[model samples]
Target chain A: METSTRVPNPFAKRVIVVDWGTTSLRCMLVEPDGEIARETESSRGIRFIADRAFEPELMNALSSWFDEFGNLPVIALGMITSRNGWIEVPYVRCPATASDLADGIIQRRLPNGADLYFLPGITDTTRQPFPDVMRGEETQILGFGLDKEATIVLPGTHSKWAKVGQNRILGFQTFVTGEIFALMSEHSFIAKAAAKSEGIDWESYDRGVRVAENATAGDAAFLTQLFSVRTGMLANELKSEEMQDYVSGLLIGLEFRQARDCGWMKAGDSVGIVGNDGLNDRYRRAAAIFDLVTVDGGEHAAIAGALEIFASVKARSDAA
Target chain B: METSTRVPNPFAKRVIVVDWGTTSLRCMLVEPDGEIARETESSRGIRFIADRAFEPELMNALSSWFDEFGNLPVIALGMITSRNGWIEVPYVRCPATASDLADGIIQRRLPNGADLYFLPGITDTTRQPFPDVMRGEETQILGFGLDKEATIVLPGTHSKWAKVGQNRILGFQTFVTGEIFALMSEHSFIAKAAAKSEGIDWESYDRGVRVAENATAGDAAFLTQLFSVRTGMLANELKSEEMQDYVSGLLIGLEFRQARDCGWMKAGDSVGIVGNDGLNDRYRRAAAIFDLVTVDGGEHAAIAGALEIFASVKARSDAA
Candidate 1:
């Protein structure tokens, strides 16, 4: 059924949203109503253009796209505004809202007179001992209209579990689970312990989760178990995939426990996943152990969030 | 003050002792008195010859070395006898002597009429429910005369802490400390935290040792502190070398604590290091914390171990 009327393309001027990530760059052209019109992407990520500043290369790439539709209003998110990116937008302490991000500095010039707005990353100060910072995902979280309280999990090389409240990032923690697993599997002696496997072994992974959850040895000491995987394999006790799954389960499970210990999420708290299908499934499975519900965090939410921030900025500018 | 000893003529019959490692090959021509007459080496190691049987490439390399001399009794050690090598000598459970290894197997006419004796790796049965194996180091341990009673620390990619008593390996445990440090420094996010320092920071290393010794986090979890190094550096709380030392100390210190926990060594135990100099020093410093005395595990010990094994084998063959 029809829910609401679509806003006229008052910004028929078109709003451009860019999700500049580590490995890929994605740009979406949106009408005033936040409906995607034309989308373009490239292999140009932070890694490819890291040696240079973000603007010229990004402008050159986007200029080609914008040549078709002249002088569009562009809003950029992600690592592009990081210290190494096109512009360094300072981190806004979390529990932040779209208004807070919309209030961040907007780069108005490309040295060539191209107007651009960069979103400031969010940091959660509620974490007493220290604070956690997030860049692009803040836009996505804001996009999710998670305007109220919720738990968000962004799984990747460094998986982040964050708590958001009232458009502000309450707090967050990062886990090097993916990076550790890759390192051990490819470089460490544990590689000797694992065989190439086609799929995950739930039992082994579950066992690993249990071990990680109940580990009495300190974290630094538990690394010794890495060798045990190989030893177990050599002894014919564990299959290869089981070994791999155990490794993954151990890491993810530990991260799960750590997040819980940090008081980031409760047993009944809802968790939202902002990642791909495989990672989402893994998080769901892990979160299920704690009986947590998860919501979808797809591209649409990110675009919605960016557009909301844009609308707020336009409103404030018009008011001023 | 002169000790009576047997001195073989420089031109006397020579025995070729082959030390084949994972990366390099070294052949030593020894006199009856166990002194080196000639030494030659090649870049051929197990990794380079992994696809080929150990005998042909090894025999070719030895023949080139022996082209200088004539036929000689050839004794080989190291990865040459691993499952992928020339021959796979099954492990002989420890409480074993040099004679046990020497008399284990002899691979004859290996691509040539060269009489080759393959050393059997040693294994420990003392650890209940499992056993550990060692291939090349058995000869070195024997050469050190450590068969009777002693504690040996063989540092490498996988450092082995072993206890020998009454001519048998009482027990041993493996610590992947070196490899873990390497992986953490090079591959893991911890590398981002560490200041790339060329030299060692003893103080920071010591501090890391203390932290690892008293680690409270679980194994994979303690890695979270790695970010603290970067944070600490950015916050001006620590220097680059200090970060390196901290990481190094944590890994080594954790290993030390684990070895101690495993009852691998006692406070008053004499620890003999059988590896390279740098690792030996690190181990010595770590051992110092526990008041354990350490001795040099030099090339002489390895040679002596090989020669001792040879003598034991000769004696056993004579008995047979």
Candidate 2:
């Protein structure tokens, strides 16, 4: 039952791991070996912090921690490192490793004597027609570990299907499934007709998945399959309560089918599902439908990743 | 230089054909032989008409016409016949002719002593997992003429790809490409980031089409390709001005690809692009890129179809 490799606090020297994104800010105090001590989150995301008041706002939120423990080194990831955030950090190209990511971190010293580091997102130049890129997710993938050679899926607004092998993060592709699902369910005529329901309609959802998986004529008949959501209702096959989940299942199922076509994964292969987007259960079920075994990734992957990458940066600097 | 089979008013007994949808109402007065005499459109679609004021609102809008024509028969189609609309008209099964549609009409007498006929939409029970249905497009396909055995593409919020032959609509499928495009460009992150620019960037749109057409991998990589619209921007391969048209081309292109996969039509085959959704030129261009010959459908196909079906109804009633 006690399986975690997290190190216990001895001297209790703390570091802050912040996953600051567009809509919210999540901060965690962790031990040197990545065991979280305390965590706090707020709506004071980059979007809300007007006139570059990020420092005062952040300090105000963590004033107690700073007062109790003095200045702690901070490592921040996510959209806060993008062009629109606190500082623009260049992306490290894949096939990347902890060291490669460490090399890409841009750092600054705060007025409170704390060192703040912003980790670089990653880009895949090998992608066809154009390079595919991901911010923040690269760190999450890093935190999920790269010892095993397997495909990993980090589901989000923009889901990433990545390959990890040889201690390096290989290339990945993005699927805008979540955003499409949101738009369709909230705005589309077929999906808008659904009466708000209390729970998931698993049967309807599975039916949608089945349609996507069995669409052998072209696994890419997404738009056509999308219309089936409406047709199903008109035919009295799908109830109004079932429309939302049905659309969800259909889009996610199509994502999996398309991912397989891109050689991301295949039937009988195991895939690691990372991220805590509340969509893991859906993806796991989808993976089961595709005959893919699910690998449980650690929930604190972001914290672990930031710590690992920052340590690598410190180690390289000390060695130099 | 002018050649039209449309009969000019020879004792023109006008019949009003109203395509009353969720967002707009389009009414056309046609001669007994189907030449459009006058047309009027308003935003008073089914969704806008409150408290069943449909009768009064319609009467008020067409009072002048009724005063002149002395109680003309009004044929109604589109969402106005749905469960949420004025009347719920059941859909006629596919492999149906004009007479079959005529037999399915649900008629009621208006307060003005005019017969109001609601034309039945068509349903393809053969569609997998559920029956596929269309409201107005079936009438348009009829207007396009069932004499020529050809595949017709009606572009709209929910576009329809229908097959016509042997004086009947054999079968058809629906693709929500327009809806998806609207959702993406208006709501999705990658698409919303594009600067609002006037006019279509044909080059960008064509590039998107090329991606869909030449996708060696799964053609249903729609979600994946949707991300490419964003990736193309991040990679500097596509300018902000080009994003809208590019996404438009990509979705429409994929629709054509999927339709071909579904055996709707093939390269070198002539396909008719019907409907006046302001998207025919784009569809025609996409059709050309797919090596299909574009057939020009009559501009007033709905009026013609409504008139023809009504005539069949009158004949059947007289025979009975």
Candidate 3:
């Protein structure tokens, strides 16, 4: 709640961006323009950092850059800002802009006198079943740029589909497609039948997407379609090696289908694909099936979004 | 495929009913009237039985039964009859009868001179995305009685929604709801938040069922709704122990909803709940939210169906 006075010309200096999660810590020393100056990472996730020890653990990763850069302002995102993180910051309810995210930031001074600003995740309270929440994807949505209205797809463990326009994330939903894919591949019955393959089998993957595309919502076919990955093998249509990609394809395809059903987009719409989840191409291919034009969110969308939020905080603080 | 002469009055004597799954073998000694005289189970699943040793494993489990009753006809179902099981009996495509399943039986003689009938699984080639298949559920539908046209739900790791009437399984679809529940409770993000409970938490369970029932298919709300389990915890709306049951309720409700979308049942229709999966009461509660009246399928639906098919095979073989 207590924010220190803003230092002048903050945009010219380096900023430390931390993506803290359950099992790992990643720190990015970035120029104002979003290019990485230096990076450090370790397994000292917030979960492993004992109570009241997060600052020290975080400093362990950020100290060298701090010593060299002379007290760079730190921006923490991801689960690091969650209730289980160093300090639990409440989520900024959408429709949120960079400035609104900035307003929701919790601030503290580091041991080295550097200001630490924890960016709050955003929630889409309008979502049915429950008010949907996302910790880090909002930044990716921002990083991808919000000037143009588009249904942005940030594919990850829990993929987010957001409607961004008018400089705010209007509302969003999470699909959990990737997590389901991982669960099926690692622990479900499909795990046994599917073999580890060398790379993504686009053919197998596209076939899965097509399967999702072919299914009508009336069929309530996602779960049933999932079973086909196994049956397809039994029917000699899908090879064991192909099962992995086929399943990935099927689930991702289902996400797109579900998103459409939720009224996220329709034919002839342009969708921006963002994030660094290594699944961009697959999503692009999936988009084509749904007749959506694609726009890349570019590299460093998260970093760009982070810096944008930081700049907004400084801009407002400087004015105040 | 080779079925020999049916010795007269096979069912009047004792029948050995075997439920052979991936990891266990269960056998029941049934009198002519479908009463289970004695039951025995062992972990000697076909997978653990080593090469050509299923017969030994079966003998180990049933040697005493054979000693007292002489050679009883062994009827096997489940994954034990799949490609990985002792014999891969092909699936009988639907709109199939008990007679069709009886006709599709692959017969072999045990070393004990008993006839072992591998019951063929049934597949609905009619399903979209891929042909839907079930190994043992069709028999449950038969056991539940095919005299009346009704929707029969067999809840298990992979639950099946089936239609039966006129002494035939009209068609059916499988929903991996139970499997997804297991996966979420044990391995997904929900696992850490959910604690093992002694019994079903009806309130939490019903809340989940209601959540699913409220969401229209167009909402594509299932995946988004699952995130609420975690968010609901964050919001302090759900307790740790309640997570398991709530998720169970949600998935099962979704299953019912999806089944309805697939034209399995309507708001006013009565559905038959079968199987011994220990979740019938919970399912009955879910069925009610959609205004569905439920009929109970008696204990040992699988066994009763098995007997019915065995009788059909015997009657046809005797006539031949």
Which candidate number has the best DockQ?
Answer: 2
lDDT of 3 by residue, A234-304 (tens): 87888899999999888888888888888989989989888776999899999999899888887677787
Q: How good is model 2 by TM-score?
A: 0.94
CA lDDT of each prediction against the hidden true structure: 0.68, 0.83, 0.82
Cα displacement (Å) at residue B248, model 1: 4.8
Please give, for residues A205-239, the per-residue lDDT of candidate 1 as tens digits: 77766655554433323445555565555556667
User: iRMS of every model, one decimal?
Assistant: 5.3, 2.3, 1.9
In terms of lDDT, the poorest run of 10 residues in model 1 chain A is: A1-10
| Isolated chain A TM-score, each model | 0.84, 0.94, 0.93
Candidate 3: clashing pairs of residues: none
Query: What ranking of all candidate models by lDDT puts the best one first?
Result: 2, 3, 1
For residues A112-213, write the lDDT of model 2, one tens digit per residue.
888888899999988766778898988778777877797999998899999998989988888998998889888887687877777777887777777888
Candidate 2 second chain TM: 0.95
- Point to the candidate with the largest lDDT: 2
